[model samples]
Target: MSKNLADLNSLEERISALEKIAENFKKRAAEIDEKGEFVYENIADLKNCGYTVLTIPKVFGGKETSLYDYIRLQEVIAQGDGATALSIGWHMGVVRNMYENKWNPKVLAAVYEDLHAGALINAAATEPQTGSPTRGGKPQTKAEKIGDKWVINGHKSFTTMSVVLDYFVVSASIKDSEEIGNFLIRKEKKGIRIEETWDSIALKGTGSHDVYFENVEVEQEDYVETLGGAKRVNPWLLHIPACYLGIAGAAQKEAVLFAKNYAPNSITGTISELPSVRTKIGELELKMLQAKYFLYSVSKKWDETKEEERELLLPQLSAAKLVVTNTAIEVVDLAMRIVGARSLSAKSPLQRYYRDVRAGLHNPPMDDMTIGQLANFSLNKY
Candidate 1:
């Protein structure tokens, strides 16, 4: 077997190794959240593990793990720290998308090389004027063709991983054209800087700040894709819902531990022995199981699906994301109830989980949009 394929055969072993490394992230998660600082050390640890380039194809000297493998690893990382997991998810998803789509050959080669060297990338599409790109909002940022360069000027909001990104795949309206192109901008380039503007109550350590660009120049080859391209069902995006489910897993663990050990004077045994507590725990487990099965089953289907048949599964994919993310929020809430008032303490990780899971509701494939799409899909199918 090829070395890369052979390595993938040992995914469980590799995941075990990653789990050990995640311990340090779990240990430092509270501190990172409390300080509201970027998880630089976590990123460094992931890079050292060759995770930063996991999405680059094997030909480019990367692991080129499948979407399932990537989702599994992301869930493991999220179990330790949701902010770190979410921050890195952008990089992993972007790289995987580039590899799968094979954009401009020259640009892809450069990005692959950078990925090998531990570079991170995220699509800078959301702007102050337009909320989510999925909502079909045109970018306010504009890219103009100069003598031999494309000069870009615009601002992007919620630029996740801004503190650690080496490149940004930004969306900009083409000057004098109706087209909106995704431009690749380097971090060290002049006139591109991250503004300290993110002050969200959740995902506090994601470094998702406002990014500004004024006359940032790049070659024409840097523009990856024009907006309004044919849409495809993106299975890799399942990593997002997976991350929140991981956070819920952490909260569940904490709650179970508390229920097993905290025996009050009024009870004959620990709270876990109480019928009411057991019912809540059962409900939590059932919901989690359903969401996970939906996620992984759909992910596996995507892996085996023919390219032409993939678009037919868009409703299922969106439904999985919506179900898993919404279930994650409720799972965290139930976990907190299991832990009672102690879950509210700053020292408890449940509070962090509660806040972090809510961010998933705002992620792409938004709940309302997904519901509307599902309704349309059902009517059309009938």
Candidate 2:
């Protein structure tokens, strides 16, 4: 683990640099998708640019990026490469959790160092039997306290960036106790292996695979967070929608470019001359504007609001995720229609965008669940 010169410049400069770097990934992104390989180069680029530790608090030798700033940068990255943006978003979000003092002092110190060194950590809470831990299913993974170390064993699904993660925050039930905790395990330890199980057509380069832990030993203090009761919607997690929104933006750009220049032998002019094509573009723009307002305003609200007030904003956050993700999907569909059959060709990105945007529908704070929660709130108020 080493440190880079803290490029303590203006936030705008930092964001602009990252956006430029992301733009460079477009070709690489297509290659990664075609090969169905991990976006290893993309992660390495982010690390080299010192973007990996941007969220660590200033006091802990990081840029201390604001939640809004984080989302804004992620959108830029996603616009260029959705899989890379998504893979790193999990790392950025989980590391930001440390700012809330969620981990013990010793653990926090070690984590800060690891993160600054460009290490990635993700919460491996999704299990085969329990699905997403957010659904309140008990984890089949168990940890036993033997002497001074905690021995952990279990399987995790959808471990995004498993190939590059240096550490994992794994949730496990204590051997004898009813309590569950998040154990921090280093990747170098024995008994930890990546299962290479992810074969999804969407986000093919994310490298989200199954990980198995067999008798992995961790220090007592490594159990950082208890798998406690339900928690409030984290405003930082808005990065999820930010990623999808970027994908939508990319699709819109592709469609607009094609419309502006595509002249056919049978047509009198380019597609941009067609009223229907213009209308679809207009719709995409309107939806994007609405989604951006919803996302940024709520994110700003989260930053300004007190922690207690933040808990009550679950509906707004959930709505932002639902609206943005749905809007992204629609935008991609429109892009595909505008581009016609060519959009579906493997050479075109619109098809990939269509597939990737749909994954957002399955992300946490699911559409149906959000609607139900909103209805529950409205009914109680009414």
How many residue pairs collide in each prediction?
0, 0
lDDT of each: 0.87, 0.87
Lowest lDDT sum, 10 consecutive residues, model 1, at 1-10
- Tell me the tens digit of each residue's lDDT in model 2 across 1-382: 1223147466577667777788877878778888899999999998988888888887787777877878888999999899999999999988888658468877888889988877888889899898877678989999999999999999999999999899898999999899988888999999998999999989999999999999999988898887677774677778899999999999999999999999998889998999999999899899889989999898888888988777888888888999999999989998999999999898998988988898998788788888998998899887
Which pairs of residues collide in candidate 1? none
Per-model TM-score on C-alpha atoms? 0.96, 0.96
Local error of candidate 1 at residue 287 (angstroms): 1.2
The list of candidate 1 runs beyond 4 A from truth reads 1-8
Cα lDDT, model 2, residue 177: 92
Q: What is the lDDT of candidate 2?
A: 0.87
Candidate 1 accuracy as TM-score: 0.96
